[model samples]
Target: MTQIAALRVKKPDAPSSAGLLASLRGVSKAYATPAGSFMALQNIDLDIASGRFIAIVGKSGSGKTTLANLLTGIDSATSGSIRIGGVALEQKSEEELTAWRGRNVGVVFQFFQLLPTLTVVENVMLPMDFCRIGQTRDRRPRAMSLLAQLGIAEQADKLPSDLSGGQQQRAAIARALANDPQILVADEPTGNLDSHTTLEVMELFRSLTREGRTVVMVTHERDLGAFFTETVELADGQIVAIHNGEARP
Candidate 1:
């Protein structure tokens, strides 16, 4: 096994073998253009099992990001239903969805979105502040602990600009984990990384699954497919195939 930092957060009770962490039924998304409505997703159904590393892969304009947005409650669907951890997303108002997402989902982006003015530890603590998850004094300690878990404790006092790309990304991941969300939704997380760093980050994400967290990532990198437990392929706003990721030796 690769040497990846372990996540020691208190995990929820493990679900049954057949448990579904997220589900979508008849989901579709469309945006209005000058010509007409451009459909991004069309009548999609998906079930994401708990503790799985799921990859959504497809060419550009395949609705990969749109699907990721729907899963994270960052965007609403035009039609159909989405449930994550048994909470209906479509029914929630924008305010409700924001609160629900803060507690239930953590989103990772391609670029490290850390605030340049804040130290790495402060960046990690921001989510706790926004969500009011812990005491003010306790937040920094928890942030430091999360940074340590990600093997970036020494960088906690430094601003994101002072860290390397990999270190910055690690800080971002630590920040995402601050609230202990059930699911981590990453949109092309490795897009800005070099190949070596990408592999390291992918392994770190894989380890999160072992700690009983589901990870849903959107990527077009087929070479990195081996790290995912399952792959959902889409094309022309529709699911083309679903299959197990290739096993790595």
Candidate 2:
């Protein structure tokens, strides 16, 4: 038998054969302008399984951010369907979406958008406070644990300005994971860091997937593709190609 066939035979059956944590079907987004409607994305169809590490890559104006925004419910789609964890986000009210996003998705931005006055641990705890994820007494411990997981526990008491760029980014990631979200959406997460720091952060993301969290990152850096299990290429506001750990042409 072929190696691929043998491997498939040896694999265990999944608890659920649905094989998807989130999906977008024929999705499109457009913005109104003086001249006409500007389409940012068109007929996007994607399926992301649980625990998968996915990277969406494209140049500026490629609609990578728009796709991420739609997936995370940061913005509404102009049309089509977005289903997350079997819940159709497109139909939810704004308040419902906010609560759903807080419980289901964790977001990391390019800029380490931490408060200047707050300490690292405090900043991490703030998300839980906003989302009301857990009891007030447990929030600090949870934040500390997340920081420790990212190898930034020692810097928890320091201010964002006091830490190095990489450390601050780690803190931001810790904050994003504060609510133990099922999905993590990051936009250019390592864009500001040096090569070494980028590697460190990428490793952390890889580990998170091992713990069964789905991760979707938007990046222009092709070098970072190695860290992901799958890569989706976007161009002209549409998916151009998908690669599963294969060498790019």
lDDT tens digits, residue span 31-103, model 1:
9999999999999987666556888888899999999999899999999999887899999999999999887
lDDT of each: 0.83, 0.80
The whole-model C-alpha lDDT of candidate 2 against the native structure comes to: 0.80
After superposition, the stretches of candidate 2 with alpha carbons farther than 4 Å from their true spots are 1-17, 246-249
Deviation (Å) of 247 in candidate 1: 9.2
Error of 1 at 133 (Å): 0.2
Q: After superposition, how far is residue 18 of candidate 2 from its true place, in Å?
A: 2.2
Overall local distance difference test of candidate 1? 0.83
Where does candidate 2 clash, by residue pair? none
Summed over model 1, clashes come to 0
Local lDDT at 38 for model 1: 100
Q: Kindly give the number of clashing pairs for every candidate.
A: 0, 0
Could you tell me every candidate's TM-score relative to the true structure? Answer: 0.91, 0.90
Over the stretch 1-249, how does candidate 2's per-residue lDDT look in tens digits? 000000000011223335556667889999999999989999888766654678888778889999999988999998999887789998999999999988777899989899999999999999789888779999999889888888889999999999999999999988988877767889998999999999998998887777666678888887776777777788889888877772132
